[model samples]
Target: MQLKNAALYLLSLSLLALAGAITYFAASLRDINSSLPQIIDTVEKVNQNIAPLVAEAADIKKQIPAILKESEQIRVSINETIKEAEKLNSQLPVALTESKNWRILVPIIVKEAELARETLNSGIQEINLVRQEIPVSITRVESLITESRNIGKETSEGAVAGVFSGALRAPFELIAGIGNSVFSIFKSEEIILDNSDKEMILETVQALINASEFGKTTAWKNPATTRSGEITLVNATTIKKARCFNFLFKFNDQKPHSENVSTILCETEQGSLEVVR
Candidate 1:
């Protein structure tokens, strides 16, 4: 009976040890499973958070070139506008002169035409006599134009040439136009300067000079379509005085026509002239 009781106690002790080992191993396995599932869930949430940011970075990279191209286009357009404005600024003077009411001043021009008529009329007979004897006032006109060209060239090569460099730059520059006008006047047989006409033209010329002093001279040039004139430093008087002079005369059949006259104002360096050509 003693041996059986000892054997039963040993067996009970072995059974309790085995049950304790099994319970410890089961609890450790449960803890490991719970930790693994939590780690997996954390990794999944991290991937979800990073996805939108990655997509946004890719989208910005793709749009960068388009935004840069638009910026370049805007810069180019602004430069073009600036260039156009510069061009317009260069042409504004002539454009403003051409738009004024020149025809309204014609009656005033007619009233002051007598002296110019006499000068041109008296000069006609001389021109006709020369034409009959010489046969070529046109050639003379060409010669005068050539001489003027030489003078202009010489002047342009000197210190005073700087004054005309910009004037020669306009597309419709008046330098060539003035030469053409001189030729046209010489070609006409009916345009002559008589002695009486010369006096009248001179008187009117003086009055016009006076007008240039008190009034503004806009779009007038030396030597109108059929006249001859000059501009000099001597004429650069007070802004209210004559800064330039343009003499004119008329002729019929290469003879002096004392009754007809024409006169005009010319350009000047002064500031007060109304350049209303």
Candidate 2:
């Protein structure tokens, strides 16, 4: 019985220790259960951050080929620019010389253009002056030509009259001697046909009176045709500041008849005939 008690005590002690350890384990398990929601929230936050980083890494990987291509193009462009700069340096001296030459000629070109414009303006003015004067000059020339024609016509007429007067002079001299003594013979019924013949016959009779006898004897007598009495001229004198002659005709014209006539004439102070009576 004592041994059975002792075994039973030992079993009860072991069971008490076991119960205490189980109680401690149960309290630790309660604490673990209480912190499990915070741990899960931390793990979920860490997974959320890792998922974005993974997506960004994938996007960077996708763009790598385009980035490399752009880098290569930039290198090629830089090389081409360096080569163009080298070429420009080689041609720089000649380009500067051409620019200097153009600068030197610019003033000369501008002066030549100004001179050309002035010369053209002068030529245009000269042309306008000529145009304005041409019609006036033509009109003056036409007036001169007309005046010359009129002068020539007058000269021709004067020459013809002079020739005609000279032609009648010789024939007039032949009849002058007989006409002075015989001019009053014709009657109104006689064969007097032409007025020019009557004038010629009368002028021949008057020419028979010598100019030397003007103041001494103013009398003139002429034989009559088919009449018994003679024709006479008297009063050969100056009157009214003019030379005049008076005529007396007495003859048989179907009967004894008498007529009187007067003529006015002009003469120079020297007694030379100026105008016919």
Candidate 3:
């Protein structure tokens, strides 16, 4: 009987160990089941994020050709920019020099502009005054010219009783009226009569006067200039009671050169004044 009781106790111990192992395995399986939904949710989130990244990567791949083309264009543009920059660098110094020269001239240009403005203003007033005076001056000149013509007519017809016996009055009106210069040959100085229309000098020619009656010196000049010359007649009579007179003269203008000349005047049988030499 005692042996049978020992066998029952060992059998009970084996049954309890088997039951504890089964219960532990059941608890571990329950914990794994509870965590499965959270793991599945994490996996779903990872898939959702990864799907957009994949789509974006594919789109980027599609854009690669256009990006490469743009990059090539940008490289060409950079090369062109470099070339243009180099050209500008080469030309920059000359451009800078021109700009500097313009800068230097600015003050002078402004000053000249101001001076021109002043000159123009003054010139307008002067021009108005000149306009007013010109007509009166012209009228006086015309009257003087008419008077000179009459004087020339009277002088050319004047006959000397002793020397000019058969003298016909020769009118030197052209020579006299042109210059409008009344040159009394006995005067000390005279202005040269210039004919502006003909661009010729009007020289006065008169019959030789008695040497003692006229002065031995005369001066001549242009109307516009002060430069003048004097001629001194040293000898006037060539022969006693001769029809022709020879005059010796020494002349000087301001120049270093001087001239000594012998001039002959003949009273023709018709009583006209003639220069022989």
For each candidate, what TM-score against the reference?
0.21, 0.34, 0.37
Q: Give the per-residue Cα lDDT of candidate 1 at 253.
A: 32
Off by over 4 Å in 1: 1-49, 102-277
Name model 3 segments beyond 4 Å from true.
1-30, 124-277
Please give the distance, in angstroms, between residue 99's alpha carbon in candidate 1 and its true position after superposition. Answer: 2.7
Clashing pairs in 2: 181-223, 185-225
| Candidate 3 residue-wise lDDT at 201 | 21
Candidate 3 overall lDDT versus native: 0.55
The weakest ten consecutive residues by lDDT in model 2 span 163-172
By TM-score rank, best first, the candidates go 3, 2, 1
Q: Residues 1-277, candidate 1: write the lDDT tens digits.
A: 9999999999999999999999999999999888998899999999998999999999999999999999899999999999999999988987877756566677778867977888889999788877786647455445544543454476524432332222222111123223333223334455554444344333443343433222232222223333332221222212233233333333333223323233333444432222222
Q: What is candidate 2's lDDT per residue for 9-94, written digit by digit as tens?
A: 99999999999999999999999999999999999999999999999999999999999999999999999999999999999999
Worst 10 residues of 1 by lDDT: 165-174
TM-score of 2: 0.34
Tens digits of lDDT, candidate 3, 1-277: 8999999998899899999999999999899899999999999999999999999999999999999999999999999999999999999999999999999999999999999999999999999999999999677556545544443354433332222222112222223332222222323342232243122222312322321223455555544533344444332332334444445544343445455556565544444434555
